[model samples]
Target: MLDLTKLAQQMQGMSQQLTLEATATRQRLELAEKLLSHAFSRQNKLTTHQQTWHDRLSFTAAEPVEPLNLRIAIPVPPAAHTVIATDGSQIAPSHHEIAYCYLINVGRIILHYGQNRLPLLDSLPEVFYRPEDLYISRQWGIRTEEWMGFRRTVSEAVVLGELGERIKDEGGGMRDEKRQNRETRNQRVEAVASFHPSSPIPHPPPHPSSPIPHPSLAMVDGSLIHWFLEPLPGEARDRILPPVLAAWDQLRTNRIPLVGYVSASRSGEMVNFLRLQACPYDTPDCMTHCSNQGDRSPCQVLDPLKDAALWATQLEPGQRSPLWRSSARILDLYGDHRIYFCYVHVGTEVARIEFPAWVAEDADLLDAALSLTLAQVQKGYGYPVALAEAHNQAVVRGGDRARFFALLEQQMIRAGLRNVGTSYKEARKRGSIA
Candidate 1:
């Protein structure tokens, strides 16, 4: 017989813990609300964050306008353009399985739109299986990290590069079959034009003026800078550099602008900027002098309000902030490909968009890149449809994961390796007690 008094005591303890957690959460929220109010009130007064914080911060960001205006909007995308988006999905090495293997599945989309309202979508998916593919060098000692995800992301960019190459080819696959048959090419083009304004793609004897090529934009699903691409201690940069460099080379050679689109980012670059603004002029450097951690930092009054929080109300749909340079550790190695970023309003949310400094320097390419991205936002109703579609193609659903394991087991049986077995824990999870 259990003691009723003990049970009551335990329940009371649980309730007390819950109450404490709730109080702490509320305190955090109140601090956030306070900072947000201050930011909004001082938006106009807090200009020049870049000048003060540029050297101290690992990354830099700026509002497009000094006074924090809310009515700004970017122009509509050019009449026609191409957008290629790539996303990665993976299955980690499962302890439940016999083999120490993992898989990386990549989804790629090629979208061309403009004269036609509907986008023509072409998708490709690839799977990788190799020892090198499954594991990174042991010096960093992180076997559990998803190295394959990074590899797939690099490969995804390669996909865009290849497509761009094909399109740029004088007589490549992008060249329409009908156009090759010179006798009836004109007639076919007219027929396609009459029947389907959008269908007549991949061929044009030549566009009248400067043809806006199909690969004007290549979009990545996440931040381009990641640990895998960065220099690790004791690991030779030579081994890790070629693929990423080649991928960037491919995009550049084809004159395709690449963007690393980050949705719902909580990056603190803007917060650091705000902190720098709050620094007392008397202090040479506040970060060192005022090294208080957490809510105790002198700038903690501005705690928890990220760039997204500050600009969510300020940026109108399709509007974007001025570009910022990233001084992140990995970017230090990027050489001529230093990344620049801006916050763009996609209607549903404010997102961080990053591109190479090259795009920022080239006015024409920058405009084209922005227009292409904004059009995607409109087409997808606040989110880029190409990114959405690529994610759909790349995502590894639970059912598919189970099916893949089943297929692997079946293949093992066929190869006379039926003796292979899974952990009892895995079997129990499958159906053991249920």
Candidate 2:
């Protein structure tokens, strides 16, 4: 149990330390803001040096796709559009349990606006109890919890892709109906023109398909980078990344905007890029120049701040920063679906919004995606409604975990399994001890 009195006593010193850090952070933020203005003054030189030195840097740095200082107001989304989001929760395998097993529950939410359609919210749960499922590889000594977390991520992506496919199918049906109606009208016009050859069929009105009915978006609740796969062996990575890439491919091929929303992110990719700009060397190198300096280095002036700190001042509510190509090594395996990101100030906080390269390249799709994201945030009151709904469906409470184990024990007894029992610690905790 936590001792409140001791914690209370320690809070005094903690408060003092935090106050000191806050004062230091203010000075650093001022320096960073000035440094950013200085770097942008010679944008051409910064870009040239970054292009040349990006690969050599030891830290991850964002590659600018647009002017570094560019910030755009959020566009209005179409009246009728769909936003689908997926999230996942998992139960890790426990040694204290009667059975070595885990569960993954993926939540899916689809919200339609301006059409007055009811939203769709549901979850899909799968249980893994086999030995192969419990262990990734005995040789690699991979833990179940780590592997299971990645597995849950995969589940989230696959479910999001499935929802994307569903939306496409629904849209396709609508398109087919429109096509049939057009064909039927053309035939009637031909028939009427045949009876009166002098009258012409009004030239068929050029490109008759009214604008491609608002855009649809697919969203997942976290980073699309799959950073977890970075440390795994080639075989393990191979087993994990293919499905995720396939899911991204599905959205790209269908022209569906896909995004990963991260709220109040502490990432420093863009801040590291600023560090590159602050480097004194003509050709930037982290190991050779700044290796021994640690916090004393010139480039370390902004080390205390995250990317969000830098943008919070630059971006107003409903505005977003310019796109930057992520430097994650896992993205090299992403093919044409390489992840790109921008920071958006969504009233509540600065959020890191990541999407595939295809979405970033297209002007219309980019606007539509961000607009719909902003719309979702407004509707949900600071968070994306679809993602928020999905979280509600995905969350598993503490009581649910207890009941899960209880159900497993009962099922085992019904199946006549022998030597099935909880750990002594688990039993003692459950038993009365006063």
Candidate 3:
């Protein structure tokens, strides 16, 4: 009797397992049938001329407007949380190397002397003005029209965060590590080194044998360098030293800002400036030529000090001057009562596009711009076609086949793909047989 009871239990367990397996199989089969029906229906609806037209269009009709390249500058105070979002494909075809940046809670954005905005202002505030608002106001004689484009760019920045968050929330197989690495890179750590100095400072030399550092660092004015490298007392220095060192290490491996010249011809002037600064490193080969004219031409050298001079000139603040604007202007903008600044690079070789001010103030407008931009890119590159294909495949293979079929039917009706007299119920009924 005990053996008989054990056998019966085993049989019951097997029966349950078999039932589940059969149910899963049935669902998969139904899904396949539904997908076939949907495809067939679509094919039937499209006349031969429509199919030919679609084939000929080839998704290249929606080319994006050529990107416009402009320098953008935003004044970030010490320790402010600044978020910068960049989309490479939005402005042009992505070439694998795209830059993104984020700045965190710092001081007020200096619109003009004595005007500023509070740190951490929301993207959209219901009340345009408040007594304690720290944002730079146009009423203070700051130019608003010039900065309007920057605001639109920042609103789009939110899209980067959204894309990141979506990837984090949705876990898939194999690509998890890649997504994590991207998130890690996007996170902005607090900067330990300060760029502002309170007192007169001493000059620090570069390590004796490092390659000429990027020209941008070389061009940092003496005053700015002193401020950036301002000394902290023993205890404070010890506390921040580790992070500063880490940042320095990261900068070495990553693309630190290189000095940009107003013109390729002025490179020699920059080289001379670096020599005066007494930097020990070599000049970049790309910036200057060998001075030795005889049979023995001196090995062309990079002048680090000159590079720094060029960098400083590039970073200088002036609207009309050739040397004053760097690429930073593409990131800052002006708006009603406040100035919005971003420092992310968003552009392509063809054109570097910046945002308009109105879009930045309105979330809906920002979304619309992104959607439109994405659609344009998709039309040009066939990205949307790939996405549509993948989505169709997933719907066809997903569990709950009946529900999937019902949804497809509803879509068809909404799309006006079928006659009003024929309900989804009728189409679905006919679909199963066909």
Q: What lDDT does model 3 reach?
A: 0.26
Error of 2 at 53 (Å): 1.9
lDDT score at residue 290, model 2, on the 0-100 scale: 76
Assess each prediction's global lDDT (C-alpha) against the native: 0.64, 0.81, 0.26
RMSD of candidates 1 onward, in order: 7.0, 8.4, 30.7
Per-residue lDDT of model 2, residues 1-434, tens digit only: 79999899999999999999989988878887887888787767877777777677777888878887798999988889988899999888888889989999899887777754456788888999988887755546678888888788888888887776665654554456466665564554344224222344333322212333558888887777878788889888887899988887777766788988888788998888888768888778777777887778887778768999889989999899988999888888888989999999999999999999999999878998899998888998998988989998998889978888889888999999988889899889888678
lDDT of 3 by residue, 200-299 (tens): 2222323323222111110100010111112324332233333423332322322121111111122232122122112122332212332333323232
Q: Candidate 3 regions off by >4 Å?
A: 1-136, 172-434
lDDT string, candidate 1, 1-434, tens digits: 59998799789889999898767655645555455456556654454455555565333444333333333466677666778777767777776775557666767676656523223344454444566655554556545444555556566766666655434442232245534665354554354334322244445533323333443788887787664555455353454555676777766766778888888887866555555445565432545665455356565555555777656655777788756666566776787787877788887899888888777777777777877887887888878888999888888899988777778788878898856778888877778544
Q: Which regions in candidate 2 have their CA more than 4 angstroms from the true location? A: 175-212
